[model samples]
Target: MPRSALPPLPPPAHLRPWLDDAVLRADRARFLTDLSRRSLGIGRLLLLWAVAAVFVLGWTFVGMAWMDVERHEFFSYVHGLIYTVLGVGVLIPAVFWLVRGIRQDRQVRQLLHAWVESDRDPAADARLRAPGLSLVWLLASFALGVLGLWVAFGAAASAGPSRTTSGELAYIMGTGQILWITGLLGLAKAVVHYRWAVRAFRSRN
Candidate 1:
């Protein structure tokens, strides 16, 4: 090939000045909007934020009861109940959602990969390959949840009317309650679990 026969670089298309500026502005705006979703994702890393409110409510009741300055006072006992309920209410669901949801999500992802039934079973669809939660795991959750509730009851009883209390204990009680409620959900699954457990007996019947 001769030097004079060399292909020249294609000139860039000339966009209208205002149109080019608009395109650039639009691109920048889109980039920012996309980043916003990722920025907001940081909060999801700490689901405890939702549980924080109940902690405050629980601590408040304990502090108020502690201020009553009475021994074996009925009012103080009732005051303790306020924190106890608030703690249990928040804890039960928070713990259930947080631990079980997170755990099941992880396990399913793992099982989805390891599932060999797809190869051997003709009926194995994508749904069958999908990982399912085990009753055993759910039972464990219920046990833990009940244990958490027990702790909350203890916290409530300890924050007596005569004792000086602070609002910070709400977090502890809230967490304890979370464990209990989540566990309850796990335990509640026992209805279905027992069905399978007694399947051998039911089959005979």
Candidate 2:
């Protein structure tokens, strides 16, 4: 009589680095705390950006209306248009990140629960430690940075002698500066994420 043996199961695809049971047991509390901090940080950042966007939008509209009424000029309309577009450009990504962060917070909580239930199984731990960066997010970050730069440059160029008045120069410069700073910040974030991704890949390989 002959007997057959079952084939070995494949490892989890999402398994990541730093999933050892000892590490998990030692750092579980800190890890959860860090997750909470990240969630709260993201929430605060989103709220701040949302408020800023609203303020900018309101200022653009009200200022444009006032300018049109007082000066009888179309330049205000153009300025409003540029500011609105840039504001929206930044707002959209901020919203996306906010939503994503909320979802990630939930996911991490579930993972924490699973890890506890599983007694910190290696596979579960690996799943929890899996890298979150994706091509879509990377591309979006890059696009946001580019858009910010483009808006900044456009704002600055629009303030040139032929198109704008002395009174408008300050507004244009302020808008450009805001956009440039935001763009640089976004780029820096992207770079940091990209480095993390590289490290994750290297570890996995």
Candidate 3:
């Protein structure tokens, strides 16, 4: 059998010094590069993008509560409290992960830059480019946006304006809006990643 392409992962943490040595840093960067490739692989990335919809779902309830408050509806305060609780439950983790990802990306870039400059590792550059991942992101984002549009607008079109109750209409509208906006977010993410990948490829060449 052929040998594995990736470098072995760094040793157990207890073996490292107070600050990372060059070997440790390069090994860690290589490990993270491998992880990034796995996470951004087509099927896995698509699923990860789909999970982003939960953010829209949480915000939908918050919007519903806001509308209720604005209209002075009977359940305004109670629904607002309940919706706020539910939204917060979802949002806290969402925010946590968002912040974590940002920090991780920064650290990964810093380590990768140092490793590449010092070691002249070509595999790291290739992995960072992530050849097909950007195309997958673009395709997935487009598909998601199309689905969102159908969900958000199809309800009214099918039910007709006069047939649906206010609550029913609101529910459908909110769900649809969530899907549509989530798709937009996915598209934005795709664009950003694609641009970054393009730059990575150019830098490699």
Candidate 4:
């Protein structure tokens, strides 16, 4: 096929990064290192969440230990209410994300579309990758928030006769509603991550 006979497609100058070749560069070490950096931001968010949850549980347990058994249940209700309010009653803890995801997810899908079929137009693909990257950031935020909430429950779950340290039982919403909700949020993030992966592949290629 003569170059002159072919129809002009999209330019390939700017869009190469988001495309597959740039991302999965044959240099395995660089590829893994790059991927780690890209994914680490989200991991830190999760770690922060874990740290915060620990503080909350610790404070609550210390306060409860000072009180008698009769007063313990009060803290239980109090703890429950705190998390419920924070999470908007647990049942629909991810309500905001559900709403946000619908729009964001659509944008991501559209991004995938443009990248995959843009006729090599790098600018259009670049625009799509922007939304995809933003979506990854959003997922990271959600994961961090949920991870922090779970840390408290995880701490409580580890509590035993030797570990309870007294007053700690009250902090153990073993069925830590908030932690479970947080897990759900992380699960949602996985879906978003998958979408970004798809979009990233197209942009790189």
Q: Report the C-alpha lDDT of model 3 over 1-205, residue by residue, as the tens digit.
A: 1223433434445665654686665765656565465445565455455446666667667666665665566778788778878887886786676566556545545444444444345555566665466667667767877886787688767775467655456667676765666567556656765676676556656
Q: Write candidate 2's Cα lDDT for 8-59 as tens digits.
A: 1222335534367565454554453344334333443444345435445544
**Each prediction's number of clashing residue pairs:** 6, 0, 0, 10
Residue-level error in angstroms, candidate 1, position 205:
8.9
Residues 1-205, candidate 4, lDDT per residue (tens digit)? Answer: 3421212232364875667763333332332223333332455345434643544454454444433343458776666555545433332423444454345444544443333443443443343333444456566656655665576567666878765654555544432544555555555545565566565665567
For candidate 3, list the clashing residue pairs, or say none. none
Overall lDDT per candidate, in order of appearance: 0.44, 0.47, 0.61, 0.47
Query: Residue 45: error of model 3 in Å?
Result: 3.0
**Best candidate (score: lDDT):** 3
What does candidate 1's lDDT look like per residue over 1-205, in tens digits? 2421212221133543435554544433333223222222223223333443444454455444444423457876776666566656755665576575456434433333232211222232222211233444454665677778777777876875455244435545765775676556445544433443244233333
1 versus 2: better TM-score goes to: 2
Per-model TM-score, in order, reads 0.32, 0.41, 0.57, 0.33
Alpha-carbon runs more than 4 Å astray in model 2? 1-48, 51-137, 160-162, 197-205
Q: Model 4: residues >4 Å from true position, as ranges?
A: 1-119, 127-154, 161-205
Error of 1 at 101 (Å): 5.5
Q: Against the true structure, candidate 4 has what lDDT?
A: 0.47
Ranked candidates (TM-score, high to low): 3, 2, 4, 1
Q: How far does residue 23 in candidate 3 sit from its true spot (Å)? A: 3.6
lDDT of 3 at 109: 51
